[model samples]
Target chain A: MAEISFPLPDLGEGLIEATVLEWLVTEGEMVERNHPLVEVETTKSAVELPSPQAGKVVRTYGEPGETIKVGDPLIVFEVPDDTAGIVGTVPKEEAPKRRVRLSANLDED
Target chain B: MSEHTTLSDLEAAQDNTTAADVQQESVQNFPEPADAGATETMSMQQALNRALAEVMTENPRALILGEDVGQLGGVFRITDGLQKKFGEARVFDTPLAESGILGMSVGLAMAGYHPIPEVQFDGFAYPAVNQIICQVGRMNYRSRGTLPMPITLRVPSFGGIRAPEHHGESLEAMFAHVPGLKVVSPSGPNEAYHLLKYAAARQDPVIFMEPKSRYWQKGPVNAGADAAGYSPNGSRVVREGKHLTLVAWGAMVARCLQVAELAAEDGIEIEVLDLRWLKPIDAEGLAASVAKTRRAVVVHEAPRTSGLGAEVASTITERCFGTLKAPVERVTGFDVPYPSGDLEDEYIPNIDRILYGIQRVLEYRRG
Candidate 1:
């Protein structure tokens, strides 16, 4: 098992910090990716930040009415070692399909 | 040696020079395995992730710093899980300041740390050009070797993803022009894996242009094998042909291969050469391929005016002048500013345009 932290990401448009309006998931709660974890309000607007990856919530930082800076850990997750938490979509590994078979002829002058 | 001796030596060298001596030295042979041992079918993104993991593991001094790199695992997740695997200190994020990201890397490099900084997107690198070209490129020369800027600046590059105006521009021509910066673009997953590792290991700063469009495309990558024989600074012939050579790099390499396939149906054999390194272009490799085919076409997504294609065409003309059947042709984007996503299909060199380029070269006459 490994512990992964989810930082308060820059919501958009250079908003540096956000105030924690509420926590959607509590400690030891299991969450799936994109599941709402917190509702935070930045200068732009109040937005619900989703869980970046699926894991058992180890802890969530900041309380209602508290502020957290961007890039600061908002929550942590305990996940299996192999699943290594990922944010964006890592395209599934599929066998490369190529119509024009090419060779890497490095030795050919 | 004395100035007089230098002059005499110059004259002696001139006396011994032959037509063969004028040709660019052939690229050094690196016996890359026909099959990378213990290969894993992986996407370019996964390969890059694996490479960074290996780089961090092998070199404690090597760390990655850029916008959204740490907890977020990069905007593309190329640095995914790296912070967790390594640590926050080694794989951390900076604020959305491109200049600061690069500037700090220069300082870190000066202090004996190998920094692998990502500019997030190709368009974002514009804000950091001053730091990249002035400090990162010239630091070692200016310091007279006292400080070597061993930096790997990763920029997700090129169009085809329908990105915004600035996000998909091809900046290889601009980076290749710099005196001290070494530019390399990997065409696929295997190339990305080996090339990124190769760039990170070098003492000089390398601009590693990751082909964003090809990031999701999966291919074989040997995680255990080291990129021993190949020079990341040299080009490689990905396909062999006798009719014509289609010279390209990055996303265009794959496109050219597709063109070659279509051309094959029409009985036209096309060679696709991936010009891996943009700066010290494998002129010898270009000459060797074009000389055999007696025809050539350079394809790129960048605008045609003073682009890298012009340099490539000129090199082929100079080296293969005696044996060439026709002038080198180019299939490239227009001279206008790289457009937004909606207009990308028109801006990037497509298969039909490349086929026309090949046709032009094949049908050229001495008249």
Candidate 2:
């Protein structure tokens, strides 16, 4: 098994950190790809973070009241060898040619 | 109260492919509704919602697009139930994108669709200024009359709600300055209903401003005789008096009427003029009112410096020159950023400020 650390993704509108509202998964819980892993709230709207791959949640980082900064570890997952190298921003199903809809990484119109 | 969202940041989330999702070919071919009902009391916001529903129903070409306008039914609920009533294919939400929504509307209008795109709030309009000022406002002239761009931009405006910064602003003068566009602000529900329908039916672009402050203010609305009630014939004289012409528009109209009643108690008869059409202002009607009253007080929530109040005052001086018994007076907000929550009362022109204008105008004598 390979351990993978997942950092908080940069939520747009210049929000640097967000308060954790709820944890959708507990440590050692098996989760499928794109399952909502955590609910975090910024000033404008509440957003749910989707897990990148199917894995056993090794550890969860923050309590409900804690604030997590972008690029900080949010969760740790123990994944099979096939799921290694999968990381933040890029969901498992995304292709190199396909454009992600995140606000910051948008290519020119 | 956070830092304003930048245009570049806003532009990033815009999905241009949504324009292709517009399935309808044209609105000109849509069937017209036979029944235009009689008077029913409703709030200004409710009347606006009804207007969008009726227009969407009658003209297959007319569609509404804005943030939270679809499933959320708008933050103000002005577009409440429209998406369900008309179908999401027509009344759909766009990405939290203003420029994208407004820019696509010009193309839709060119393709024979009447797109009633809402900007959500006044401060939000700045992000779409390029689309509004450069594109839709000049589509006809830029392409000649060959392309009759008839898009209606709905903006919820004004203060008194103590809303957050950039959420409440009075930027109508900026729109009114552009020559090719029509600027309209309805004082109450009846006008909101009729003027919206009229602007939708119009062949040119119109900036239909709704005073958010008076959104819940209720009054009768007769859809059939609605057109008969509001003729776009220069402001409606909602209250009649002889002391002076108390001119105001949007949310300020109700306030001016209240101030007029207060002045009446002091034996001053104030004629309240709701300048519904702010662009080609009711110069003739205003002249007539001023000639009759011999004094005029222009009121608005915008800053006094370079505000539309100054324009109204200048216009009165120009049209009602010899007949004017006194210099035109103005009741307006101070030249400062719209203050936050508790400081709103001191910002918006209240009844006392309006009364001061009337009193000042009354004291003036032609020298």
Candidate 3:
């Protein structure tokens, strides 16, 4: 398993720091992607931070009412190693299965 | 890593009746993916990451700079885990400015640093065209060899993921037209690994176009420390046949290979030639393959008007005119602004279209 630390993303336009209002999910809990992981209050407004990926929540940084800076570690999740943390949608490989047939090999030995 | 089946010793064997014979001896001489060395199954993304890592470790002067490349490991994560491995200075990020990224690379190259600048996406490269064509392309000639731009500009190119308009574009023709720029795109993980390292070790500027669509597609890659002998100068005969040749690069190469396989079911043998280097194209390789089959069809994601396919078709005609049976057919995208995800199915050439093209060439005859 690989440990991926989720950074506190910029919640709003240029918001530097946010106060942790509540932890929606506690440590050692299962989390689903896009679900509310934590609720934090920025200078402008309070918002819930979604889990970036599905994994087991190993740890969470900052307790309720504590301040955490943006771009800082928000939480760490343990996921299967093959799950690469990427931003875009990379299409899964689907190799077409076909019957084996001997095509001509024109190479002269 | 042990050398994986280097057919380098095999002489340039050409047989008119059998296009497959020249696979052992061709202009674009590289090991077969299965035999490229002690191989490991990896995606093109991982292969490229390994290449960048090796290049950075091998050359102290080498550095990678682009938006999100440092911390996020690039939007596609091609630079994943690199900044952590090599530190921030060598593998760092720049602001979201294509021109600034390329302009800074030019300056870094002038200062004797081998800069590997990533454009983020193919469509985003438009903002840096002035710097790319004017400075990066002409700096060596402008300085009269005093300044050799050893910069490898990595552009994640071509459409298939149904991305927004600018996110996916085949800009090979535009870059290839530039005199000083050497354009090359890898077709698979193995080619991505070898070609990227080869491009990095060059003095001239190389436009290393990575097929964004093929990023997740896995294949065997020889991730060894042997970077001394590989060169991305010519075209590779990926799959050989005697009927007709399917010429392509980037994402289209894989499509053509699939088309070839389907065509084989109909007893039509199609040779697939991966035109790796867009500029300084292996005219010899194109001629040699087409001459054997005496028929050809060029394919690409770019518009047919002046796509790289035109140059390839013209090269085949000029070199193998007498031996050719039919005019080289072009199976390509329509001449319009590349469409968004919804219309990509209609815009990009599908397998049926390519097969139809091959059919047209196969049936054509001189009066």
Candidate 4:
């Protein structure tokens, strides 16, 4: 089985800690990339954290009302056994670099 | 040897004649105006208009683009009659799309024109956020110096006037967070006019925010040398005091002025600082003010969390730690979406809240 770890995404302004307001998905439930997993309240406003990878939720590190920093793992997930080899593999750095370039082109003249 | 010397002497004589002729033509032009005294008292809108008019007249390449700027002269009439005075080519209106307006301005700037585009309202500027952050903000760095986009975005923002949702927003932090952009907001008419003129001359992209609520407010404009002190990247001490430095920008500057007046009544002396420029902030001036006052309170109309005030407070604390007598406090908008315009007074920090903040800081200093 493959493991999926969800890191905090940028909620704007390089904000680090956010209070966990609620968990939409529970352990043992399946989730898809970009699916809302937890609701977090920042000093500015409440935001929903999306799953970065598709997998079955195996565990949660923190409960509601706890504040977590950036890069803190919120949920762990188990992927299909067949896809286990690719599950935890980190994408090449070139991928993000290329994507940023492409997005920049779309907006830049 | 004699033939070569003769040819060289002839070339030198021709160069001297050409240089003399060029100097004569330059001297024949009209003389510039003499530095004169300052003119006091102009509305914020008038200040902006004067800045635009001055810049456009001084620089032929400078132009303005915004909705209703051409015929209707903008909602607040800041651009009133500019189109007629400057001709449509220099000052004109755009389609109702903020993204289109900003994106087109990027293209215009790339073509070597200085385009100062206006977002009609604070809330309406959201559509262009993508263009602003992803494109306009990073274009210079992304291009690796091959392109320099010197566009100024003029957005009239903030609340207090009972307008609909999206009318009042202090989005400076959003722009400030971007790496390659500059952000500025003026507290009064003089600053608005002077800052706009500075923005027109700048070579980098600038987000110039105007306080919508204070559009009609009037103040000493200082038409001469005092105007020179207003720059797009500097802060000014609007009032003199010793106990604490109260920092604010845009419409809040006026509010801070009112607070200072009321505080004076209570026998508390407070210095008011107008942080005209948001990005590339005047750190030196701010540090100096905080050093003298020993206490600081940053105020803004934006929400308290992750707002521009947070950055100012942290910076002051980091640089002026030993000099500070109390923890830097912030009088800002409640950590909530801007409330209805009617309840804005409650949500937005006012004279009373600022007074309370001053009292708290003073009390902390006592202990």
Candidate 5:
């Protein structure tokens, strides 16, 4: 599995760094691309940086209240098949169950 | 050590010694970048980019926010490759509104982060004048020193390459007039690199004006200066002389050097002082030089009447009145709106006009 390390981006122009407000998911959690991974505060606005890839969270850098510069590695994601372009996440399957149909209700009455 | 090529051809136009001036020895000692290690012969645009990148690399609190600073890498490409290197969260773009860019910067500074917002162009900065002139300049005072706003406003200014109406201008005097703001305009790539780093790491708001004319001018700069070499508060003497003092900022500084080459042929040693820091100008340095020369000439791309040149001339007059030989002169743009590209060369102070101003000052006699 390839570990994709995503760096913090310039949330806005002239902004070089941001303070980590919170991490949305714990390490080892499965995440999809565009998922809100972390909330960072730069200037007066607080924004969540979306995950750039769908993968199992390998590790996260910095803690709450910690400041991180743009380009500093923030989160690492482990992917089974490391795709070059953006890869979407598919959630795990739920338990299988039977369904009942009510299409003949009027004829039976 | 001077690599600058003076306009020797200009001497042919007027019967002055422009050729001899350009041939003078030891004009200046532009520091070698390798003295510190890992230097690049980058242009002003690239130098500024490296400074922004280095500052961002060192300080987690420094962030860049502006229009097209991200993805597009800024209009001048100064901020190009920064967004990708820093991340969109830290090097992101903003709306086209000028006020919005600066307004957010003020808020960001108050939130305990240092912000460097790019105003894009000289003309585009007008919309953000309110935030820059009123709030950004007075925030520390308004909060009674409780709030410290360390915002560096990056504005590309000056004329010569025939840019559109608003893009070509030198509004340093307007911003320098605002109290609590440090106005700085770098003449070349080195100052652009060092000054931007100094401005970004300071505790006050700085109007960091980049000379558009010299954006492509290449020079060697200590790629990384441990943020220790220069402070964004003083001037630099680009060339040393004794006959008279030539005070200029931004693009005009380089032009003054060319003007000096012409004046040298006439046996007039012109001292070229680059007011890198416009506001809180190096009055002491300027006074000392003007005192020795007993003559002065101020140059800028702004309209005359009440531009930066006037301010410099007045200050020198006030400080060096006892050692005065003649009235301080000013060579500047006409007191009207800038004309189109075809007429810009004439409207802005070229080397010819500057040479004329220097000659006029040299002829000054206390009658």
Candidate 6:
């Protein structure tokens, strides 16, 4: 049994949350990667949230009228057992850099 | 007989000393500054221009950029004669793009320069929203301790100027939504002077909004050695009273003060609070005042729906709920699209409107 948890993606620069306008898929449905999963309404305009992984939907965390945070899991996916091992592992070209700095100048104050 | 007379005299002397000490203590506790009745008059626009000049002279690296800022000195002449005085190098004009102005300011700061870019009007600042929200607001964090963008963007905002659409808009909430930026607006000439100096001195990006309609309005400004008016972060109690508290900023603050004066004539004492720093508001001062008064009326020229007044009202309700005598009232613009310039007087909150809000708050009964 492989489980996939998809977090909310970045909508825009200053947008923190969006209103869930409508859901495109139902429970227990299969969804492919990059497919439009939900339509979210922001202060500026309405935007579509895309699926991050290809799998069968196991659970949905929020209702249509609810708002979710940036890192909150929107959906849980059950993928093939064989592909489960590849989900958590980083690709050779995309591995984290050793010298990358994450400290922010804003923290000085 | 001689010993009895001396004892009575000593008791009387002791009582006199105690009474004198009590009087001295009270006077010392509330020492008043010598009131120098001196008045100076200058338009709000002229005051802002003077503030920019003072800051520019104090700091060589401080630069000003905006459409018409260089040659034209702004549509209202707020920056008039600045380019000639400071030279084009320090106060030059920029291309007609707000995003470019904000983005370039971020880059300039990364290269060690303080850029004070002006958005020609409140409505025109929307084009630069992308850069402000993404790059400028988060550059300090994205650069990972490598950069500090100390930029100040001046936006002339609010209605009642009889200008066209896009000219009179209160978009402070949009900028306030960004986490990394500081938003501030000055209500008078005195604040115009000190707040600009404070913005220039600080090492953070600041969006300073100036009320265009109050440009010609005059008030007393300290002409002493310390030119910059007063403390930037602290809230000023323009009018003191014990009844209700009226909170306002920018141009609306003047209207609040006026209402306080008018209310005084009707035997109602009202306290007016000027929130100099919109973000990181002086919550302590406001809450304390509201707790004392037990009634609050928040005022602003922005639309009432989801405006800055809502945030202020919520915070006050949360902090002073136990002491509040009535529900918080707000005097603001209607929730419709900003009306034409001719009808702005009816749309924006005026002195009479604020007085009405105060009366409503005072008349409410708490269960």
> B60-169 in candidate 2: lDDT tens per residue?
66778898787657767788777767777677789877889898898877766678999888889898999888888887777656566678899988887767787668
Model 3 segments beyond 4 Å from truth? Answer: A1-6, A10-14, A27-30, A43-46, A52-59, A76-88, A92-109, B1-35, B225-231
Interface root-mean-square deviation for each candidate?
A: 8.7, 26.8, 6.5, 28.2, 37.5, 30.0
Distance from true position, residue B248, model 4, in Å?
0.5
Tens digit per residue, CA lDDT, model 5, B182-262? 788888887899888877877778899988767766676665544354444567777889888899988788777876766
**What's the candidate order when arranged by decreasing lDDT?**
3, 1, 2, 5, 4, 6
lDDT at B125, model 1: 97
Better structure of 2 and 3 per TM-score: 3
* lDDT by residue (tens digit), candidate 4, B1-367: 3322232333343221121221101101111124425676777777787778788777666778988776556766677667767777667778999999999988876666678999988889899988888888777677665456678899988886666678777899988998878888888776787778777777678898888777766676766555553334568888888777999998888778777776766566789988877887777778888888888999998998899998999999999998787899999998888877468868888667887787777766334
Best by lDDT: 3
DockQ of 5: 0.01
What tens-digit string does per-residue lDDT give for candidate 1 at B1-367? 1322222332333322122321222334243656555678887888999999999888767889998888767767688788777777677889999999999999878766789999988889999999999999998889767777889999999877666667778999999999888899999998999899988988788999998878878788766744454455577888889888999999999888888877877777888899998988888888888889888999999999999999999999999998887799989999998887567778898777787777777767677
So what's the TM-score on candidate 6? 0.68
Looking at candidate 5 chain B, the ten consecutive residues that score lowest on lDDT are: B17-26
- In model 1, the runs with Cα more than 4 Å from the true position are A1-109, B1-31, B226-233
- Candidates, DockQ: 0.12, 0.02, 0.22, 0.01, 0.01, 0.01
lDDT (0 to 1) per candidate: 0.81, 0.76, 0.82, 0.74, 0.75, 0.73
Considering the two chains of model 5, state its CAPRI-style docking category: incorrect
Higher TM-score: candidate 3 or 6?
A: 3
TM-score ranking, best first: 3, 1, 2, 5, 6, 4
**TM per prediction:** 0.78, 0.70, 0.86, 0.68, 0.69, 0.68
Off by over 4 Å in 6: A1-109, B1-40, B227-229
CAPRI quality of model 2? incorrect
> How would you encode candidate 6's per-residue C-alpha lDDT over B1-367 as one tens digit per residue?
3322222333343221121211100001111123524446665666778888888777666788888787656766667778878777677789999989898888767756678999888988999999888887887767654566678889887876666678778988778889778888989887786678777766667889988767656677654464432345657677778788999998888777767766766767788888777776677778878887778999988989889898889989999998887899999998887887468878888666777787777667646
Candidate 3 CAPRI classification by DockQ: incorrect
- Clash pairs, model 4 backbone: B39-B222, B39-B223, B41-B219, B41-B220, B41-B221
Comparison by lDDT, 3 against 6, better one = 3
